[model samples]
Target: MVTINLTLNNFSELPSLLDVFGCFGNDYEYTTRGLLRRKIPPVCFICSTLMVHNGYNPHTKEGPGEINIGR
Candidate 1:
C-alpha cells in the first residue's frame, strides 16, 4: 500500500484540492490527522457555501433552479 500526505492550513482550501483528485477518480482515500473522518462527495464545497450564503435551500422554492428537498 501507498500513502499520500497533504498539508493544508485553511478549511476553505479543501474544495479546490478535492476537485483535483476527482479528475483522477476513486483511487484515493482522504483523511485528516488526529481528528474526524468522512467520505468525500462529488460536489463543490464552494458552491454549497455560496448557495447557503445566498439563502437558497434545496427544500425551498428558490434554490439552484430546482424545487424542493435536495439541491
Candidate 2:
C-alpha cells in the first residue's frame, strides 16, 4: 500500500483527483455526521501516490491539478 500526504488548500482539485484515481464507484461516496465524504480505494491511493502499480494502466495519467487544504 502507498500513502500520500495531501494538503488541500481548495476544493477545486478534489474532483480532478477523484477522477484520476477512478474513485467514483458507487460505494466511494458517503455521508458522515451530515458531511459528505469520499472513500479512497486502497489501490487507487497507492497507485496515485507511488506512481507505480503492478497493473498500472497507461490511459490513466497522473493528475496535474493542485489541491489547497487551507481554510
Best by TM-score: 1
lDDT of 1 by residue, 21-51 (tens): 5555344455554422223433334454323
TM-scores of the candidates in the order shown? 0.23, 0.20
Rate residue 66 of model 2 by lDDT: 65
RMSD of each: 13.7, 17.8
Show model 2 residue runs off by greater than 4 Å.
1-5, 23-71
Return the clash pairs for model 1, or none: none
Candidate 1 lDDT score at position 70? 65
